[model samples]
Target: MRGSIRFGEFLIFLGALFLFWQYAPWDIFSALDRADLIIAGGIGLLICFLLALVSRWFALDELIHIVALVIGAGLISLSHDVIHTANWSWGDFSFIDCSGGPFSQERDDTYTHALSANAANPNIQVQVLNGRVDVETANRPDYEVRIHTCVRGWDFDHLKEVLDQTYPKPELREDGFSFIQAKPSRGFGMSANVEIILPQSASYKVSIDSSNGRLLLENLSATDLNLSTMNGSITLTHVAAQSVKLHSTNGSLKGQLSAASLAATTTNGGVHLELTPTASGRYDVRTTNGGIELDLATQAIGYAVAADNTNGRIRVNLPQFTTQGQSRNHLSGQTANFAAASIQVSLTVHTTNGSIEIRPQ
Candidate 1:
């Protein structure tokens, strides 16, 4: 969190210092002495520790806090996984698989199955992003697919490259099916990156959460869709549905809407939506560190907007409609003049740390 560039420079400086102490022409230390190696390492660590302590007084403590928070959270998550293993097991040997770095690169035998979208189905769920998940589907689905990155064990850069490759253009297969290498399936590690796609007519409850990848819902007619993310954007575009919900912890939310009833919330993220005049649905948008933009083309029965930003602004634009209602500080009301308009909905918008704009599209 110490600004990546600064951290990189620090690392290079440490490397240069070690090189000078170890191999410089000047006779400083013997290269073959094991005790010298330990002493050198200790000295290097001491330098780093001193620099860390000095940084706390330069308003850089926040950056250190962010880094510590992420590392702590990751360790806690891993611990949770370990504690949930069967029979109080430290780890599950059979189901566990190595994933995400070089060893994950190898491709094994592949298997695939496809079904008709028109066939009878009770539920269909789709998750097309970065986490490992077990997917089950019964509808004809077309998902661009790729195998998880394979980095050799203990090679951080190689492992990072493997993760970067997850976004490659998906490879298609016959019969609306395809397969790719599973991520980090080294011998017996518990990591996966398989995704499922659902048909348009599929009316099943769905939840997709990705930490480092975008979550996009487009041209879908479904009963319900719930999406969440931490470091990626969330988009709901041209979706016509009964119930739609989205949550983004630290990313943007921007998309088009053809639905009448939509609800979304975010933290430290922005929200933007363009609604067509023919679309009249309930809406709820919020953010803690970002702004909100709401454009209502048609008449709406209720309008409630609460925009709060610790370090941001709020801008709302409401055009004159055929009907009018009460208005106050942060709340307003409008007559449902477009009752005959098929979309009966409520409107809720909020934000905390960024700008909120509601303008004409």
Candidate 2:
């Protein structure tokens, strides 16, 4: 009532944040502490004392108001799992251990499972909430998947529980195979890596989404491929796809990529790609905190590009590229139309804090 944030309101918001971050009282800062009731009492009292003076000075709320706010905050903390962590993601910030954690020893075990495949459009869709995803193409006639789960826990049993929850459940149907790992198990650390292998099909598709681990995609041909992760690097090797989309929140994009159309974006990471020469192709790659390197080697290739970098230099080294507009960090132009009718490429690459280089392979 005194200002925008009432005494009780602020306390409520704080309580909610604590719950969201899984920060119990005892584990206020430690990722391993979990004595709920005991710590919740101290936390509630601290909140009460800390906010009382502020409310008195700013809001000048009544004594009853301060008391009520503290009581409510305490209740909230006591009723929750105390999902409060110091690192509450706000604008490109995240915890070091993506899987809110015990931070104990790390272990990983690998196993292979044969999957059901569709005769027509065999697709693989993997969603790992807190681990890496790798996919490769094999000459085998069947579908197979390998899982490697790694994470920290209080003990062997706790670790097993976390790993069990992180394992992906792949379901196969006439359409394709889909697997989604449940959110990191409730009370322990959780992370898992997945590797999928399958024979090529006429219309195979690969879609992988990960919350907090690197992704490696190799030797796969698909009509459409979409790979994304909240915070990890992405690598593509000998990948052949008609259409591809790659994204990351805090990692780089690297490796060889071949596609008719490709779009990649990242934050806090660089984009380095060696694109296989294709007659006709469209590519767009951008990053916020890293450099962009693109190389296309083809004597007969003709390309039109618009490259921009906010805080670094831009260089275009293609002999055939004629610069129409140039600056320290921006370039836009295209090679003469005389390029052989066979090779035509259009590219857009941009970065905020790194240089942009386009060299002929």
Candidate 3:
């Protein structure tokens, strides 16, 4: 009986290690380097040790089990919090007072700011800890940015206070505008949705960095554009740029882009790209664990295409190119006019665990 119990404990220990390696955020090391989290961890460990010692002395197995249950519950809560706020700190250890799920409280607020677009084309940069971001052209030829904050939890006052303190106002600079969150709130769930309305007649540059949220860009013309997120989907429609780059860690990306050069990459989601015939530039898309769908204009002047998948099939629907190195997992081809190509577009798509589909629009 004792040997069986020991074996069960060993299996549990191995399972815990596997879960930590798979889901625990690697960025927690950065937090540990800080004094705050280190101090919090030290205090927590001391308390847990003392409680265990007391339970053992009193032979209170039930008490020990109760304490273990509480710790498990706390860890579950912390994991959910980490999904939204990737940064782990002492604040996250605070007990969340919400009765229901993480996002249960309800609160909403709107903020608006205007920018004076002179003769020079303006630039905009936004960073958010959580929530969706939408950028679109304004109906009028004016520059404005709007933010809608939504909070759902048991604590309303705490959420409001955090929102007001973290994001006071937009800081306007000479070349562009920026909105950054300084710190995260304790014991609450919230999200902020941002909308940037640019002048229809003017072209600008935009960059967005988000920790967790969907991003939507529509009907915007920019000289250079960059979009990145840790845990959210991305959608682009009617976007025109000279150079565009997009990245997501754990979400899908779908876009119809008109750009001189474009690159899109994701770790665990699919990618879909739709290009125009006149879109002549270098295009690259890659994902680790999801499929890829590429739609190219049938009347494209010239083309160079390559696609690969490690554990899935590959399909190409373009007739102009003669396929070589064709297999269930790899494809390489070029346009029929490869020798006399005039306006050429280079395309590359790769995925590790899913199919790759290329078709003409």
Candidate 2 regions with alpha-carbon error over 4 angstroms: 1-118, 150-167, 200-203, 277-281, 337-340
Per-residue lDDT tens digits for candidate 3, residues 50-95, read 7787664543643453444444444544454454344222311211
What are the lDDT scores of the predictions, listed in order? 0.47, 0.68, 0.67
The numbered model that scores best in lDDT is 2
lDDT tens string, model 2, 1-361?
A: 4664576577665765555435433322322233445366567667666667566454345554555565555555443423422222433333334344445434444434443554555667888766667777777656676665556543555666565545456686555688887655444555566777776554577788876567877777778889987656788888877888999876778888777888899987888898864548788899998999988765677788899888998988887678899877789998875256477888899899999989977
TM-scores, in order shown? Answer: 0.52, 0.68, 0.72
RMSD of each: 14.7, 9.1, 9.5
How far is 303's C-alpha from truth in model 2 (Å)? 0.3
lDDT of 2 at 296: 76
In Å, residue 210's CA in model 1 sits off its true spot by 1.6
Q: What does candidate 1's lDDT look like per residue over 228-264, in tens digits? A: 7644566666755556778776567787765556778
Q: Which 10-residue window of candidate 1 scores lowest in summed lDDT? A: 85-94
| Model 2: how far residue 305 lies from native, Å | 1.4
